[model samples]
Target: MTEVGKTPWHLWVVGGLSLLWNAFPAVDFTLTNLQNDFWLSQYNEEQRAFFLGTAAWANACWALGGFGSFIGSLLLLLRSRHAVPAFLASAIGLAGVSYYQLVQNGETLKRLFGQAPLYTTPVIWAVLLALIFYARAMQARGVLR
Candidate 1:
């Protein structure tokens, strides 16, 4: 059995991997919002246009999803119980962003970006849910305090 108040080995491994996994989205969110020309230039015109024309609310959702998850990973590493709420917030944000992409502008995006989003969005949701559950489990075990 794991000792109370002692950090488990799996926590470090999961937290580290989660941090690395989330970093890309966090960076992408930052660069896209900043409208960094060099970063924006990497995408084709349609892709750039899709990202550039995103609505303000959608951008806010994206920020919460990306940055919230990143913060959650950090909090997890710190053994904070607050990581649960952070991941929950990320889920809310991800839902909003997914709605915007898959429902509000689904046809347009599908035409512009193909079927990749449809496949990938569910995978992202699954990963986020898994993180949330893991954090909760850690908290329940008193690993996160």
Candidate 2:
């Protein structure tokens, strides 16, 4: 007997959308880490300084998180089981960076960025969690090779 519904249409839709969504962060992380002056110019003085002053480790975590999510999206598209670990890495990196931002730089970020994080962070975490669980579920269902 052959397995039915090995690949679902929603899988492709989710994977494609995930990849597209993650691309923004990935590209932003790359550009900011490289200190791309043109892009940096878009931000105000305080924002620019805050970003430039970010510690190396925090930047590393940002890179890992962004790239990990990007890779996880790709793996999902390819129907590969490796998406699990990739998502895990993304979560770890996000947690590390978020801790630094909230714990160490909260006042500074609030003074500079205002309420943006308050609105965005929760949604970001929600999507990350959903993607993680979704990927795991697909793996458990034997759709991911």
Candidate 3:
């Protein structure tokens, strides 16, 4: 058992890895929102148009999912208890975006991009949930004061 107030090595590992993992979404969100031509050139015109036409609320949720998770990872590294709520907010944001993509227009996306979304969305959720649970566990153990 870890001593109260003592930081565990795994916390650093998880925090660092999660931060790095979340960074990709952060960069994608920024570049996509900014309409970086070079960055967005990867997508076909139709796929780009479809993404660019996302609703304002969905955009907000996307921001939350990307930025909030990044913040949560940072907070975890800092050993802050606020990481829990940050991660929760990130999850909510992810749900909103996922609903918009998978339920609201799943067919459109599937038609455009095939099965990548179907495979990726669950992996994203799994990682986020694992981080959330890990943060909660750390908090309960007094490692995240």
Output the number of the lDDT-best candidate.
Answer: 3
Return the number of clashes found in candidate 1.
Answer: 0
Q: Write the per-residue lDDT of candidate 3 for residues 92-121, one digit (tens) a residue.
A: 999999999999999999999999999999
Assess every candidate by TM-score: 0.95, 0.94, 0.98
Between candidates 1 and 2, which one is better according to TM-score?
A: 1
Tell me which of candidates 1 and 2 scores higher on lDDT: 1
lDDT of 2 by residue, 1-145 (tens): 1364388888999999999988988999978878899878899988988888889899888988889999999999999999989989999889978888888898888888888976787787888899999999899888888
lDDT of 1 by residue, 37-94 (tens): 9989988888888998999999999999999999999999999999999999999999
Candidate 2 minimal-lDDT segment of 10 residues: 1-10
What C-alpha lDDT, on a 0 to 100 scale, does residue 66 get in candidate 1? 95
Residue-level error in angstroms, candidate 1, position 95: 0.3
User: In model 3, where is the ten-residue run with the lowest total lDDT?
Assistant: 1-10
Which regions of candidate 3 are displaced past 4 Å?
none
Clash totals, every prediction: 0, 0, 0
